[model samples]
Target: MYYAILAYHEEAAVESWTKEEDAALMTELLEINDRLVHEKSLGPAARLGSTQRAVTLRGKGAGMITDGPFAETKEQLLGFYVVDFPTLEAAVEAARDLRRVNPTAVYEIRPISLYVPGTPLTARDED
Candidate 1:
């Protein structure tokens, strides 16, 4: 099976939802989660805290560490899901369904890779 990373990016900054709307949205998102569970492809899904709480690391000579995201960008990592599917088509289909449920968010479909024991392929080799 293949793994897909479903990500989102908001076009503009917005306030948190109201209590009533938040409840309704939760119910709808739960339904989507149910669908994934039914398909037997939902591995792990969760919403992350704001990027302000993030601590990013980068490698330098002698192992140096950095703080915060590598660089500030308009897009932030709101949340993610690790889904296992039989094919890229199936993964993209799931992403489409998710987009339908939350039309305001932009969905980025990325394929996850596995590392083999010997003769591992580098990113350039895969390309």
Candidate 2:
């Protein structure tokens, strides 16, 4: 099954981390990621840009565009990981692995109902 692991953390706390501190944390996290990659369980993962750079659209159609996220919460959705695991337990374990390195963040796991594979685009396609 495919799972989406949503990473949430206090933006301020993360922003306060020094470059070296952040790099060290990522190094630890990547160690686990490397294991997942070897197992072929890892999929798409991403780190989101700061909320200050985000925008929200409310209502329908064009909607009402506004700066920042939709809600003002202590924790912001910082990043996400898409992974494939045989069972929920396995997926949770993977999230646990991630949490071990970054204990402060919250991991939200949900089974993906549908997945559409995109066609690989070449550099020439951008032009």
Candidate 3:
């Protein structure tokens, strides 16, 4: 199975979204999910809230626990999608679909690593 992560930020008109707008967007995503399901390509998807409600923890022994993100960023991670696709082309297509609805926002596509337990690290990607 392959997975991709899709995220957006402040560019979305979330604050201006009305009930009707929310319904329409949900409908659009539902349609996409339907297509994926038909092709047996669906996995997990989620939409997250703003980072204003975030909490952060720091330090190792008896460290500080703070109420908010660890770092300040203009754009916060808005959501993610994990889908099973035949190839990277399919994953890019999914990202394109997302970008259509959120024109001003950005979508990042990344593959997940499936590392086995008790295995030494080979190469780690920078966060």
Candidate 4:
């Protein structure tokens, strides 16, 4: 099964990190990425630009265009990892490993619903 690991963190807290602290965090993240790659479970992953730069679109057609995210929250969506794991337990373990790098970070692990080219859209079990 495929899981989407969504990362969330406080922008203020992240911005307050020292250069060395940020570098060390990046190093740890890179190591995690390497481990995931070696396991062949890693898929698409990326760090998103700040939410302040985001544009939110709501309603039908060109109605209600707004600045920033859909909702205002203390923790912002920072990044995500799409991973393929055999079981929910395995995916949870992977998420736990990722959390070790930054205890302050929050991860939302959700199963990915695949779209069959000629079939109807479906949803996987939510985690």
TM-score per model over all chains: 0.72, 0.87, 0.75, 0.86
Candidate lDDT scores, in order, read: 0.68, 0.89, 0.72, 0.88
What TM-score does candidate 3 reach?
Answer: 0.75
Question: What pairs collide in candidate 3?
Answer: none
Candidates 1 and 3 compared by TM-score, better number: 3
Best-matching candidate per TM-score: 2
Runs off by more than 4 Å, candidate 3: 70-72, 114-127
> What's model 1's overall lDDT?
0.68
Q: Write the per-residue lDDT of candidate 2 for residues 6-67, one digit (tens) a residue.
A: 99999999999999999999999889889999999999889999999999889888799899
What TM-score, to 2 decimals, does candidate 4 have? 0.86
Model 1: per-residue Cα lDDT over 1-127, one tens digit each: 6565556654235236677775776688778789889988887788766666677665776665555565465666677777778777888888887777676766666667645579767673231
21 in model 1: Cα distance from truth in Å? 2.9
Off by over 4 Å in 4: 114-127
lDDT of 2 at 112: 75
User: Could you tally the backbone clashes for each prediction?
Assistant: 0, 0, 0, 0
lDDT digits (tens) for residues 7-125 of candidate 3:
76673467568989878887987787788778787677788866667777789998887886744656667778787776777888887886786666677878675455799855754
Ranked by TM-score, top first = 2, 4, 3, 1
Please, what are the lDDT tens digits per residue for candidate 4 over residues 12-117?
8998899999999989998998999999989888998877789888898777868888656789999999988999788888889889999999999988875548
